[model samples]
Structures are given as C-alpha cells and as structure tokens.
Target: MSALPAVIDGRDKRKNPMNIFAQIRELITTTLDTMVQDGTLPDGLNFDPITAEPPRDAAHGDMATNAAMVLAKPAGMKPRDIADALAAKLTSDARITSAEVAGPGFLNLRLAPSVWQAVAKTVLDEGTAFGRGTVGNGLKVNVEYVSANPTGPLHVGHTRGAVFGDALASLLDFAGFDVTREYYINDGGAQVDVLARSVYLRYQEAHGQEVAFPDGTYPGDYLIEVGEALKAKVGDDYLDKGEQYWLEDVRTFATEKMMDLIRSDLKALGVEMDVFYSEKSLYGTGLIEAALKDLKDKGLIYEGVLEPPKGKKPEDWEPREQTLFRSTDHGDDVDRPVMKSDGGWTYFAPDIAYHYDKVQRGFDLLIDVFGADHGGYVKRMKAAVSALSDGKVPLDIKLTQLVKLFKNGEPFKMSKRAGTFVTLRDVVDQVGPDVTRFVMLTRKNDAMLDFDFDKVLEQSRENPVFYVQYAHARVASVLRKAADAGIATDDATLAAADLSLLDHDSELLLLRKLAEWPRLVETAARTNEPHRVAFYLYELAGDFHGLWNKGNEVTSLRFIQEGDPATSQAKIALARATAIVIAAGLGILGVNPAEEMR
Candidate 1:
C-alpha cells in the first residue's frame, strides 16, 4: 500500500483526490521495487524520505527524485555512480526524456514537453477537479480553530486563526480527508460572567438607570443591544435581584447573543464551522469528570503540588496540593492540575473532555489552530490527547504567529477608545476575502506576518497576493480575448495544438512549472500545512508573470497569435492552465478567483 496522509471532512465536501504526482510516486516506487527484485538497490533499506520534488531552478529538470542520494550508502556506491545508473535506468522509461546527474549525485529527469502539454489538457478536462490530489485518504480529522471567546466580536488576531483554519480545512478536504470544523465555546469560564455583568449594565441603562462601566466588565457597546433585548424579554423579572437569582439566566442569554455576533462575524469573513461544542457542557454532567476518571484509571492522574513555573511564580505562590494529572508521563513538564483547591475544575478540564470527545467520535487525527499566545499550551494539550486516546490519535497543534498591522510603515495601533478591537469584517471589508485569506497565509504558521494596510492593496508585483491574482486575471483576460477573436477554446483543440510549436526555453520553463502543481499539492497536503499552498501559488504566479512579460520582447510568445486561431488556441491553453491552477489554489484558500481584475 502506498503511504497516504489522513484528511478530515464533514457531512459535505469530497474526500481527497489521488493526484497525478501520487501516481508518479507509485510508479517511481514500483520501479524501485522492480530494481530491488532484479538486484539493484539493496532489499533492507528505508525509502520513506525518497521524495520527488521540483528543483528550485527549472533548468535543472521537470522533476528530481532523491532515490539516487538515498540509495547511495545502502547500495555501497558513490552518489554520482548511483545517480548515473539510476539515470540510465530511468531514461529507459517511456515517460522520461532525458535523465542527467547534476550536483553531488542529484538525478534530474526531464520529461517530454508533451508531458507538460498533457498536464494543461488534463487540467482543462478536470476543471476544479484537476488538482484534487489525495495524499490524504478518508481518515477522520477534527480541525478546531477560531474558538475565540464569545465575549465580543472576533478581533484581528482571531481573523488569522479563522482564515488559516477555514483554508486548511478546505485544503484537507481536497486532499481527501473526512474533516470536521469545530469551535469550542468558552462560555463556561469567568469571561462569560464578565459578559453577563456587562450586559446587566446595558440592561440597567435600557431601564433608564445610570450605569458606570467597571473594570473587567466588557465595555464594548456591542452587548448593549443584547442587554436591551434581554430587558424586553424578561421585563425586569430579575431586576435588583442578587447574583443567585439572575447570573445563570443572564449568562445563558448573553452567551447566546455573543455567539450570534461571533457567527455573524465569521460569516462576514466567509468562515463556517461544522460543530460548536460548548465548554460549559463539559461540566456538571460528569463529562470532564469522566474524562479525568478515564485518565486516573489509567494512572495518569493524581493529587500533587506543582513546582512554580520557570518564570516568575504567582505572588500567591503557595504550592497548595491540588488534583493533578500525571502529564509528565505522557511528555509534559511535571503534572498539571485538573481541579483547583476551591473544588472547581481547572481550565484544562473541559479541554481534555473536548479532545476526548473528538477521539471518541472516531477521528483518526486532530488539528488545533491556536494563536501564538497559546504556544505554551501545545505540549499539555498533546499530552492530554496522548493519554486520553492511549496514543491512537495524533494531534497536530499549529500556532499562528502574530499579525502586525501597519499602515504605510507606521504600526497600526488598534484604537482603544474605538472599542475592544478590530473585527474580521474590517479586514474583509477593506481588502476582500481573497486578499485577506491569501495575505494571512503568506507566512508560515509559526512565523510572524506583517499585514501592511497600504502595501497589500498596492497593485504592484511586490505584493504577492495581487501579483498572483493578477496572473490569474491576466490569463483569463487573454483567453477571453482569444475566444472573441474566433480561437477555439475547447480542450481537444488545445490538446492537439501542435504543442511541438512550444520549443522556446521560456515556454518550456513555464510548462515545467505547470508540471510541479500536482507534486506541490501532494506535498502541501501531506504536511497538513496550507501555507505551502500559498508559497507555491506565489512561485507559480511569479513564473507566469515573467513569461507574460517575455511576450513584449518575443512577439511569437504572445498568447494571442494574430490571424492563426489554432496556434492561438494552443498558446491560450497554457494561460488557461495557469488560471485553473490559481483557481484551484484560491479554492483551497476559500478565496474566490477573479475572472478579471475589477
């Protein structure tokens, strides 16, 4: 069986598609297997990392496999010797045109240019289905993200996690995984109580009573309407009542209102979640207790005093004994408290139950997208999942680094007097979802992103998002022009368009970049990091843009071959293929591809 990464999907969405590159991988591995049978590579060797990656430079080849380098030590030969033998063998294959050894034993394989033309035709034939490569089979996965507290509307920080998670889920779906998008409600915490008090102040104001906003009580006027609505619903039923009489009802009412606001906030940003699990549900019903009991039964829980954390210990640093989980056994620093001294569950309690519920739901994998602020939470959460699932489930927690906002090189400080912060709607409204999503993904999950208000909106080539989108739009415009000029835009015509006419080195390099799409998708999906998709799209767009500019110098390279419909159709097919890949990538990012730039 070929190795496949697991993907998560929900009730909707198609599972991952096994792409052309994966087929190539299987073929290459089969070739190796045959070699082993015929006494070429030694039998006892690990080939897990034997990858077929595109070279950074296209002049190197269409595709380069590390098989030569990997088998060098095992085959007891010099890297070059192994590469030479491998090249000689691969050159015999029908798909390979030329195989040459480069560098210190790197085997570069150049396929027939017909191979690239066929790729374009394949993409046209498949449409959106072209790049749906499955490194991930239908394994159940839960992607938890943007579980921002329902205290207010989502801020700019939540926007990054929201876009990252939504795009990631889309990418995984295309890569063939059963995925569930979940949001864990934080309504069970002290934050919710604060929300209630804030709403009460609003309710009192609605009753024509003067109210002063207190510290820690949410001062965002967002909850004022919720408070007014509450007053209209209950008619001061709990008016002047103590906390015992109204706290629960207010919290329930306020949280529902907050969640409604949050849902609308997500809708404004084009994000949707499959499930919204309430952290409050984990308490009182013995769910958190049951999760803890399960761990305790497995000897992973106990009562103990934890040493103060490495940094400054709390001023209240009495190491009073508390109920602790033996997280160290599962790879955590010391033990972690499941319950506080006051007989209340720690914040980690429901989190454990939440993950346990996910594992219990039969998901094969779990992914959590958290902000960089929660970087310290990674190990403990991993430890909990490890202990709860008994190692059956693998959890990958991605920490989205901070997004620094800048307006023309000045740090864009969020206006404190304006409100709690900027919402996802602000960014989407200003830049549109495509730019917002693409810009957020330009950096890796762990690296900080500088979101410049002015720069991303600039239509220059330096702005990666616009540059990529422009390439797609430019290609689309050329295709439209070709059709208007009576050029056949059908796949069959383009497929037979004397692709042999594409002999220029510039055209060949573009074709090679096109070939890398399938491989790039499979790799990005395998790593479960959609940022790779963003990078690949930028690079592909870069190649396309360079080729487009080349047309100014080389008249024949222009996509619109004047007076020749067939040749124009052939040239336009490459442009169409470029748009198709960009659209595919934008689809994964949950961003819409423009047919033309407006």
Candidate 2:
C-alpha cells in the first residue's frame, strides 16, 4: 500500500488525529463538501448517515464507507455515479493508496503502510491517553450502583452490578466526563428493622444466651462480629429492654456495621464509591416532600385511585385513593403511587426523592446500575428522573443479569459464611479481584452470564481474561528480550526507530487494530457499554496473538531481528503499541494489565 499526503485539505479539525477511521471519515466528508461546492452533488444533501468502518471481511479492504449509498438518492444521482466521483476524489489524496467502488456503490479504501506505522508512533507518544476521548465534554454524571440494602454482605448478583458500575464509571471518566461513583445505602426501610432484630439475636448469642434466628432475620455468620461489637459497646444495658426501647438505636448501629461489611466487600472487589448517600437521611428531612412538591408544582401529583394490579386476584387486590405521580405522562406505563391513603410513603417515593436529589445536584446525566430483578423498576425510575429534571437531564438505567457460578462442572453452592448466598468476598477471595472484575464484565449487563470457575481459571483462549492478559505479558516478554539483546527498547527509542521497516502484512494488521482504539473508546462510551471495551480487547489480543503465531513460521514477522537492531526496533515498536492499547483497555475495565503470566 502507498502512503497518502499527511496533510489533507478541509479535514475536520475536531476529529482525533490519531484515530485512523475518524481521520479517513473526515477526509471523506471534506471530499463530499468539495463535491457540493463544485456542484457535482446537490447542495442540500445530508451526509450524517455516511460512516467509515472496517469491512466485515478483511480481504475486502482496510476500511469501507457507505457515503455513496447514503447520499445517492439525495444527490439525485446513481450510486455508482457518486461512488465513481467519490472514489476519484478520495484517491487524489496521497494517504489513500486505493479507493475501489464495490458491490453497488460501497467504497472500500486502503491506506498507505505509513498510515498504520504512524498509529504505532502515536500510541507510544500518547501512552495510556492514546484512546482517551473528549466526547463527554466534561458533563457531570452520577453513577449509582451496588446500592444494595445495608443489611448484609453483597451477594453474587450485587457483585456483577458493582464491577459493571465501577468499570462504566471509569470508562466515562476516561471519555472526559466528570463522574461520581456513588452507592445509595438502603437504610430507610423495614429491612433495617429486620437487620436490627437479626443483630439482636446475635447479640444474645454473644451474651452467652442461646437464640434462634427467625425466618425474617438474617442468619449469616458474617453478622456475628457486628453483634459481638455491639455487645462490647452497650454491655448488658439493653439485654432485657423492650423492642421500642432499643429498636431505633440498635437499627442505626447495625446498619452502620453492615455498611462497613459492604464497604469491605467492595474493597475486596476493588470498588470504591465517591459518595454513599443514605436513604434514611431523606426521611423527616423534608427532602421527600420537596421532591414531591417539585412534581406537584408541575401538576404531576394528585390524589387518585389506581387500578388493581392486573395479575392480582379480586380478594388480594384493593384500590385506594392515594397521592400519586403522573408517571405515565413522562413515559411510564402507569402513574405511580407516591403515598398511601394512610399518609405513608411507598418504596418508590424515596427513590424518586433520591433521584430528584441527584438532579438538583446539577448532574447533566444519571446512570443507575441495578440488578436484573429490578428490571420492572426501570421505566418508573426513568419517568421520575424525566419529570424531576424537566427532560433537561437524561437517565440511563443498566440492569445487570444474574451470574450463575459453577465449580468442578457443578453449580457452586452457597457460601457457608454468608448462610444463604455467595457473597462478593467469596468470589473475590476464590479468584482474586482482577479475575472477578474481568470475568464479571465478559457479558453485556443485560445478558445472563455463566461463570464457570474451572473454565475461567484455565490458561486457554476460551478464558478471555487470561487470553488478554497473556497478550500483554507476551509483549512484556518481547521487551525483555529486546533489552537483553542490548537493543534500545524504551518507547521513545522504539518510536523514533525506522518504522518504515515494519512493512509485513502481519505487523500492519496489528497496527490497524491499534488505530481502532480511540474509535472504540468513543463508540463504547457513547453507548454506555463498558463490556464492549472488554470485547474489543479480546479481539485485539487475538490479532496480536495471530501475528505472534505467524512469526513462528515467518521469521521476519518476529518482533526481534537478531543482529538487525533497526528492524528489531521497528517490530518492537509494534509490540509495545499493542501492549499500550491492552493496558489502556484493561484500565478502563478496572483490571490490572499483567506484566508476566504466573
């Protein structure tokens, strides 16, 4: 492939220069503009639908664009006519070695080898910042995830939400958003009362009194220490007290202790929240009232009777006049009740107030990472945010599906320490934080994931975490080998090497993959899908491994050339660029890039 001119006239200055796809797309758009200016195409033709991406088949070309197909009708010209004209204009640019119109107006373009070579140099120059984007434009986003009730240690389901939320927050931050990692402590409900009662039983056990855990109480051994600590703090002062005498105080103390356990569980999984807002804080604080007032002022709140839930039997259903929010007006399926006829707030009332608090805090966007069981809650939460924010701010709710764990080809049993379910600590302790985090994100948040313990730990390509990490480790090995051979292997030395020597197709293929990093970051960030980052890394690792395997047959494709320092440096530059991108992707996924495989 031949190199095009480094400077193309009318290129969009806003596009990232290092993103090969963006650069080429800019060139195409600018060329289209020229077409319009020269009266070759209609002036009012819209170019928004035009896209330049890699072709589905690698044999086709380096990049493909649908400019001709998308603009043909609007330009009042045949697709081939526009394709022919566009191809001629695109080839005129020196960077494009060839532009072929294929399959009825699709334009396939190939860039010079130097364009791919420059991608390596850019990656070395930018390091971890190579794929960072400015698309967020510094918008404030609050990501509330793992807001599990502070009643016990987080379970496997909460584990998925924690990892997904943390990685998504990191991805958004990498994409230039001012992100706040938050957890809402669910402490303002009857669950805390249950927690208090559970701890009271354990407290009696600590006082050398045998107590039975009731069906509604937590039966986990993880709460034993909390009870012992409570005994140490209050002695026997409340040993024989009535429920009302110690219920509120014990509830507050137990919730804090469980929150501490939750925090430790999160830390074990490498998640740390920027904020931990409390649900109890909204009660008796006028915050809930203020939020409802905001909706009422907008004429969204009224006392009305809701239809009995459709699936409920007549005897089980009761229609009552209650204070309700006109949620349907804001896209919810039905108006939601804010308060009962007896003047008690419903569960959703506090949630609405919580999000209203987020909206009032000046966030440009809000994201809630909830377990899949909360799927039914999505629409109402969105409606609340839409109504509360007056449609100025957008809310994106991501529901993480269940993670079914298996050990030795059998379903993993519940943790003995947690009593009824597997806790986050159990998962992290068994596989380690890095493995836990990476494996949790292997699937989309909304899809069910089967986390086979034996499979995930296997050192095989089927294990994506190991596969990606091994690629990074392989690059590290190459750097070590280059160093032992007395070759200059630092990024600056390799970047300044004679990169023109990297003319092999395998090397160029790796470079092409590196060039997609920035584009991938932007696309994944725009869609709020951090799992896409994990997917891209796996694909990138496969490409790197393919090139590595090719080196075994074709000696010239090896990352190091014996006695040829210049060629070795050029090839090493490619390897180092691959590592840089893998590390950057892992950073976004909250996984540490392994320097050497164990």
Candidate 3:
C-alpha cells in the first residue's frame, strides 16, 4: 500500500476533515483544558506554549508534548505531577490508546490504528486537496523573480531562480495566500544600451554591410533576428547615422524583442507571471522622484559623502557629496547613495521606487527571488522596504545559488545562441519541463546544485524524479489490475472499504508518513521554500516503494488478493490514497505525476 489509507462514504467526505495531526493536536489541547477545569491542574494557565508533535523516536509514541514542562513553573507545580494528571485525562479519548510520561515531563501519546486509517480515507476523498492548509489566512503576498535584464536570454542561473520562485508561489497559493507573481524588467540600465549597439551591428549586417562587433557590443546570435526586424521597419534610414539618431529607438526595439525571447523561454518552462513591471517607467513617470521625495520628507534622504567601503575600495573611489538615503538608520550597514554626483539617479533609486510601488499595492508581504550574487544587496533592500513602508510591510529575499550542468561526467557546453551562457531553452528542450523543474528543486535554493542530464533521466533510485513518478505509476498499475480482475476500484467504492483490514507494521508506517502532509505543507509555506515539498515527496515515494516491494514476498500484504473483494478493496484503498497525495505534491512542484512508467 502507498502511504495513506482511506475509507469514507459521501456523508463522511462532507463531515470528516483531512488533517489527522491537527485532530490529535486538538485532542491534546482539549484534554489539557479538561484537567484545568476539573481543578487537577492550576487555572489561568496559558496553553499557547503547549505543543503536539511526533516524537523523534517512533517507539516512544506517535505524538509527544511538553505541556507539563512548559506549565510547571507557571503553575508552581512539579512537572511530573502535571504530566501524570494530563496523561490520565488523555487516555479516556477513544482515539488515543496510550499516554505515558517519560524522562522529566514529556507526554508521549499513542493513538489507535483507526486514526491512521482515517487519514488514508481523507486522502482518497479530498484527492489533491489532502495536504492543502489555510496558514496564510488570505494575506496578500508579492513574489518577484526572474527579473533578468531585458538585454539577453535567461541563463542557467535564472532558470533555477525561475523554477524555485514559480514553485514557491504555487505552494503559497495552496496554503491559501493571495499570491502575485511579478517580474521587474531592467530596461533602463546601461546594459540595454550595449544590447542596442550590438543589435545595430546586426542591423548593418542585415543591410548587407560589413560591421565589426567590438569588445563592448553583444555578439550573440539572438540579436540577429531583432536586427533584421529593425532593418525591415526602417530600411537604410539610420544606416550611417551617428549614435544620436538611432540609439534610443534601437534600445527600445531590441529590449522588447529580447523580452519576447525571454517570455517564450518562460512559456517553454511553464512559468507565467501576473505582472511585468518596467524600470524605464520609473524614470519618466516621476516614480523614482516621488519615492525619493517620500524618503526626503521622512528625513531619510540627505546630501552626504559615504566612507570608502571597508577592505575593498575601488581604485577610483573618491568622496563626493551626493543625494543619499539614510539606510543605516534602518539596519543597513552603511548609508546608500540614491543619486550620483552628475545629478543622475543611482541604481538604488529605481529599486527603492519599485519596492515602494509594491508596498503601495497593499501586499502584506513581499518576497524577492534573486541569484546568490545578490547576497550583498539583501541588507540594503530590506532597509529600503522597511523605510518605505514604515515597518508595516515585510520583505523576504531568497537567493538561489549556482546550478552547474553536466552530461556524461563532463560539463555541458555553452549555448551558441546566447554567446557565453547556456540558455533556459537549452535545458528545457533537452530534459523537458517536468524533469527540469523537479531536479532544479531537489536542493535548497541557497545550496549549489549539480544538475546531471544522464543521471536525472535514468530510471533508478538515485533519480528522485524517476523514483517519485515510478511510485505513482505503480498505484496506477494496481488500479488497472484490480479492474481487470472484475473488481470495482473507483474512489467512492474504495473510500467505502473496511480500512481496519490494514494492520501490518509496514502499512501503518506508510500511513504515518502520509499523515505528515498537512503539517509539512504549512511549515514549507511559512518558510517560503518549495524544495521542502520536493524532499517530502521523495521520502513519501521511498516509503511507498518499500511497501510495494515487501508485498512481493508477503502474500496477504499485496494490494490485490484473489477471490476476496472485501479484503482486496481495503488494501487497494491505501494504494489509491498514496497516489492521490503523490499527485498533489507533484502539482505543487509544477510536475505532472506519471500514470505509468514506460
């Protein structure tokens, strides 16, 4: 049987909730309250400190709590005295079979087998909504990621950030957060000028002129099409003109085409953004000036000279009075410049404006997914958001470390189209979107990931994507076999089965793992890390595979039992629930669960 076991009728589906962990936690809380009301424990106790979580050692019990230790000092009573009284009150519940106090004051409670069986039924009834929770309480959150410069195609690094950010958004949405995915285009930067110059050379080439690409100009083949499009629109009009005549028009045109290329790449990876904000808009629309005015009104903007950065000052570094933001007052290490000595706004000016816009959008939380190279920017970015929102809005910045790609034990070559880096298209086209997304999330966002093409595709235990997909496919096979044997295996029929038939140690262990889904989802969502979902899915798959292999040698443990419909349906119910959970988890990661392994 796959991890969870399920058995429920239509009425049971509407009445019974899915989270067994929460149920047991409530039971523990209610038992503690009863003890307080009966005068066995002291009154006016703050039960907020009480916790019900699975014990580190499974043999101790299914769930353990430190209620006795937490309340002993407050109530002026010995911990063991409180624990003894609490355990006696808890064992009266039919769901909890045993409650014991161990060590000093911990209470270990073992629930009945029926409770775990009910978890399985919940999975079958709820399907993919099995692990869904409401931890966000409908708070609005803005997740900005893959805001790569509009000058070029996204490389491997941006791909990791994209996958991580997209999946994290999905996980938050599942946890009931109002999530908005955004991308900030850096079209106002100097890099777009270089892109325009590079495209100008390609435009000359399209006009049948020999133009040389200099060291500063981009020489990527991607610009060839944009240049051709430009030549087609304005043929020979600015062919020999100076930089004044065509620089602005070419910059605007090339940035738009590059953004189109980026959008196509993201579409290939199945990532969609709710908003695409432009940096160029901030410059002309008084947005940056307004943000600086807000800071100036609060005494956060001033004219000051910054000290040379500690340990690593540029050789040309010199003190100059400039428009500065007092970021140091809001936890930044030092004051940051907002405008340069030449009366032009510094890069931080637009960034502050962008965050101010996000704050003005009324989001309760803001999250930025950046590359590891932006580590130094976290402090100032947080300070900017804090000063902009006056500490009412919170900003979380997650940095995705580097991803090194390999194929057949050697480094993957760079993409010719992108000039120096491998584009996201190269990775997705080779591995497909599902494998790419799952493998990208196998490691935490801050850890360096080694993505091996040959290894990820192999159908082995070492490949987490294959391993998890295989588990789902195995359950599909079980349903097929049950149907071929003239047995009904629909979810409604399986939910009505007698789940008490599943009593083996292996089956119960799988069920316990399945029961962790809701708790895990809430924790993952709170941390803003979708990699936890991938890790949990891999572990759940391992447990399911272990049970499937055990059934080969143990006759009654098999999902199908010939000539016994009742027994077979009961065991098949467990398998069906496991598939439902695996599918649900894959959905969170933006991966499609396989129906059958090829």
Q: Specify the poorest-scoring 10-residue window by lDDT in model 3.
A: 2-11
Instruction: After superposing candidate 3 on the true structure, give the runs of residues whose Cα lies further than 4 Å from its correct spot.
Output: 1-17, 412-420
lDDT of 2 by residue, 269-294 (tens): 88999999999999999999999999
- Per-model clash counts, in order, read 10, 4, 6
Q: Which ten residues in a row have the lowest lDDT in candidate 1?
A: 5-14
Across 125-169, the per-residue lDDT of candidate 1 in tens digits comes to 777777675556677779999999988888888999999999889
TM-score to native of every candidate shown: 0.93, 0.96, 0.95
Better of 1 and 3 by TM-score: 3
Go through the candidates in order and give each one's C-alpha lDDT: 0.81, 0.89, 0.88
Measured by lDDT, the strongest candidate is 2
Tens-place lDDT digits, model 3, residues 431-504: 99999999999999999999988998999999999999999999999999999999899998999999999999
Compute the lDDT of residue 71 as modeled in candidate 3. 92
RMSD of each: 3.7, 4.6, 5.2
Residue 156 in candidate 2 has what lDDT? 91
Pick the winner on lDDT between candidates 1 and 3.
3
